[model samples]
Target: MQQLSWLPTHPDLSGAIGQAKRIEDPLQRLHEAVKLAAHQRDFTLTARLDKLAAAGIEQHAAAARLTPLRVALLSSHTVDHLLPAIRVAGLQRRLALSLHVAPYGMYRQALLADDPALNAFAPQLVVLALDAHDAPLQLPLQASQAEVDAAVAERVDELRLLWRRARERYAAQVVQQTLVPVAPPLFGSYEALVPASPRAVIERLNAAIRAAAREDGVLLLDLAWQAAAYGDGLAEPVRWHQAKQLVSPTLAPLYGEHLARIAAATAGLSRKCLVLDLDNTLWGGVIGDDGIDGIQLGQGSPS
Candidate 1:
């Protein structure tokens, strides 16, 4: 969506022109001058902000706060880069922060179970981190048309039995655990979040999820926006490369700022407790290979 228009121009047009002359790149100089004038609420300085916004250039300063609200952060990934921005934004909003890590599946299971402690926290929102590796399906299909036709004919004879069995199994599962409603549109659209999937099937599944959610009145927060903004598709190798580059000192701040914006967007939600895997996540070396003292955490040579 297009952002609002730029503010009014400043009284110091001559000074801005002088500064613009000093910049080497004519276009860049104009951009800088326009930005300076815009910040000063000068409309006559130019319509640069509107143009930049149209080009999808986000130039707002990092959000800052002195007294932040209480917020909880839940994620499986390291939050080193995200934390600073969140902290800055939270401070600006007067937010208090709490961080937690937990596996997505386990967290979902817990939420379904309606754990009192989880409910007691009464978070206004929750962020779920989903990875492509989580869902794997084994479908029944054949290469040849003859084989398919034969299989279909045989399955027709057993359709009644299959339906009964499927229904029974679904009912049993419902009795054992809560089933989150999943329907179409939103569910189908989410397939785009994956890198190597067939869009049609994903869309169908998404549609089903949306339908189910509508029927059950369950909220489904789509992270497609955030994923598209940060994810580098399903190529694991490429994602890893991008992640390394993102963590570099020069780039980390930009990532941090983006994270802060995300956190700010969901500021009211209380994050669940972080569940850590002790084996290799917390320490530099595996615990089995090295004693507790040998494991690198706070200091010493790299494990």
Candidate 2:
């Protein structure tokens, strides 16, 4: 285990990752990797450790009991940060996930063109995490509503072409994320004043994307709703400007959970029950000693 950041905050993370890496048993290694992945806030390190464990699983595939899910990740921005999140989600869902990341900014080429390398790395699922900047609908501050609408229509056609080519050439299901609205819009507060602003254009583009995904049988991941679930921290303007990050680093765990649930559902591996610990969870204190009156379980009390 290599320690790089605050140890007090992530005491067991490094150790767990190391232990998982050294373990010979594939299932045990993956279990430990999942725990380690959930604890670390450093996404880059998380991706490294998760990939290490996945490599081991591949090497020992004959002995591994769970079927491995070969997934290709296609994104417009720096998404090495999301690799571990997806792996952790797969672990939680009892699906072994092996990620193959397409070259940065080459998703269109990988999808539309008959790339031999992409075809050879045949995946079971292809995840496309797109952004407003990746699409053609991003308009200048002075653009009119007519221009924005026209651009949106063209973007939809581009998406359709990409999806059509992917399905025809690859044996994989497309999992695409709808475009997230651009923050700190070029038009500022007035951006929402009319339907022609950058914000409105992105919103309309997202809706069109969702509708197209539904009609085409693509697995849609609602990143917009996921951002809302994580609140304002999910989409900080500074992070976007600095690293082109779609969301805050702290929200990775929740993101992993959502992705895991979606993958589990798609694979028909839904959990029967969600186990939760007691004590601080079910009540304020131990249920044994705390009488019925001592326990705080009412409409007002959170317990």
Candidate 3:
């Protein structure tokens, strides 16, 4: 397999950014600009780079042969800031992504055959991002377990239909996300045992998503797993509630990186082997002193 072209040995972020910005071709500009942004830790630069990358995708379309990835994003929330970062990260892994970010709140509409824009684009990869909070209805805690189950099932059925429609209308490889439930509800303990609570509904939806992914052979990105990893930092309440930003601006890179990793793996661009430091990683301690038996991390010992 061919190795990806990473950042040049020269560590000149500004110079590289300036050079990439000058390039006329958006995809080519993205190829260089994203790498520069990935190496920088500054949030300001990340935001700028994300915007730059997005502009690249928006200003021009890649020549079919030049782009290795033609990805159309169908998302519930505004992901204009997210798609560019994802494109650049994918480039790092050797996939030249040509990202078409569908308008926000088009997650359902894009899957339908009548949507001329989606039908016209017909991307090779379809990224379907949905949020449970965006659903039209929200049942209260007073609702019974049966009622909650029915509501959850209804949403699940809608999701499955969306996947099926996408499959039927296009040959694109589908990537869908498991919804991340918001923070603790105001009902608190009262909502804890209630199966119809917001949290419970989201959990049920996630389970259904997983099952559907298995049945439909769709690529599943676990946003719930990402949320757990980041703790409360996952969702920015102010931005989420006010602007409908599904993920916080501060943690957007993490989401971008996760998306890129999955896309790279799907595109056969990810690394094949993982070298582990056996002493600490593979085993609990050094084998020379622990003599294997003393070390934990075996079938008998606690992981």
After TM-score superposition, what is the CA distance of residue 200 in candidate 1 from its true location, in Å? 3.8
lDDT of each: 0.36, 0.70, 0.69
Candidate 3 vs. true structure, TM-score: 0.74
Error of 1 at 5 (Å): 17
Off by over 4 Å in 1: 1-81, 92-94, 103-105, 112-122, 140-199, 206-221, 225-235, 238-303
- What lDDT does model 2 reach? 0.70
lDDT of 3 at 76: 85
Candidate 2 lands at a TM-score of 0.73
Model 3 collision count: 0
lDDT for each residue of candidate 3 in 124-242, tens digit (9 for 90 to 100): 77888877667634786688888877887788788778878877887777899888787567567675576777776777778877887888888887998767675544566777877
Deviation from native of the Cα of residue 227 in model 1, angstroms: 4.7
* TM-score for each candidate, following the candidate numbering: 0.34, 0.73, 0.74
By lDDT: ranked, best first: 2, 3, 1
Best TM-score goes to which candidate? 3
lDDT of 1 by residue, 73-156 (tens): 333333344444334323223343343333334544434444455445444334333322222222232224344334333432
